[model samples]
Target: MKRSNCLIEVCEDFDCSSKRIKTSFIEGNNSSKMFRNTIWYRSLLDAEKSCLKEDKLKKIHYKFQDDKEMVEEYNVDTQVLLRRAWKVKGKLGGEGKWDVEIGDPMPDATPHIEGIGADFMESKDQPKLTRRNTRINLEWRIRNLPYPIETYSVSANNDERCIVIRTTNKKYFKRLQVPELDRLNLPIEQGNIQCSHSFNTLIIAYKKPQQLLDMDKEWYLELNRVKPIKDIPNDCKTQ
Candidate 1:
């Protein structure tokens, strides 16, 4: 999906002399849409110590001086990122349950199998998006799907700029957009879409265009030229 109102920015300048860092996001295009949270530390090493996910939460705790405040901040940031990255929400299947989707268990209940006597918690083998050398691939495991390979239909809808997957019996459906193609203003071609089913899993691949490949090459070359900063002290510790 194309998001015209939101943009993600990563700050590259980390100066220990400032003794602070910011994790911020901007909504809308103009100056009126800034959302920011600053984190201060005694030194760069102190800031670095909070780089880990767990440590970041602890740092948020210190910043807000309360657990509730920390939780609200974390939730807001998480939701924003998830909405931006995961344009497609959880899929529905088999009487309204997720067959191959991203989800969390109920708040008070454990993730247990329906007929496994509650001993086996559902495994988290969620659908994943991966990139091969020349293609973007999506893999979804729906172990309960008993349909034959002939029941599935996977097609690229150039008008919608998305790949659509559907079953003849209406047991499953998904609409997936290629972020790379959308960002580059490229059209989705029906000829680039491929699909296969194996071992109760559906795999779809979209061949990458030459423009994307060229962009990747240039990005790698630029990354190699970025030198690591060596002067930041490591002795300063965070409490």
Candidate 2:
């Protein structure tokens, strides 16, 4: 028995980025080749309609599984794509061939299995915010030095309020637990901290600040004397 397959390409641009196209396949049945062809062809038409309604296709390319070359290509503006697909359906079974009984209509195409439909729907419904890739940086401070702390590490809890800092001098490590101030006036973005370590200091930057609460004005004032530098000079190279 011969196997039949259809490759349909729908793209917004010639490069085919922004979304992916999925291929459909059906095996030929010796007893009901015509019926299967009608079903598969109708399904392709339905899919094309769905893609058009969502503006997913600017160009579509179709090819058969056995053919090494593409069978047809169409621009969405013209009706030739659908017409050609229909013609291909008729050709699958010989001309004037009627496999089903007289007065019996062709059955409606079977619905595509779950998750097997075109990926156009997933791309269309994706959230705009989730697609955005943005990074944020946060500056913090520590005050009232007990020792000349050199090497520092910082991490935050899931709440974004509780922060842990570790300062090291030689072989000694001192850990400090800090909680966010109750009344913060400064804007804070919540995200994971990215740490850059140098011989004498560690600069921590937050990646996603939108999730964080405002920084405390009182806390900022108290730690102003030992605040971490918000901006690093471009000339200053650190390991």
TM-score of each: 0.42, 0.20
lDDT of 2 by residue, 123-186 (tens): 5222111011112233332223333434555555535454556556543333322211212222
Query: Which candidate leads the pack in lDDT?
Result: 1
For all candidates in order, the CA lDDT equals: 0.41, 0.30
Weakest 10 consecutive residues, lDDT, candidate 1? 79-88
Steric clashes per prediction: 0, 4
Looking at model 1, residue 11 earns an lDDT score of 26
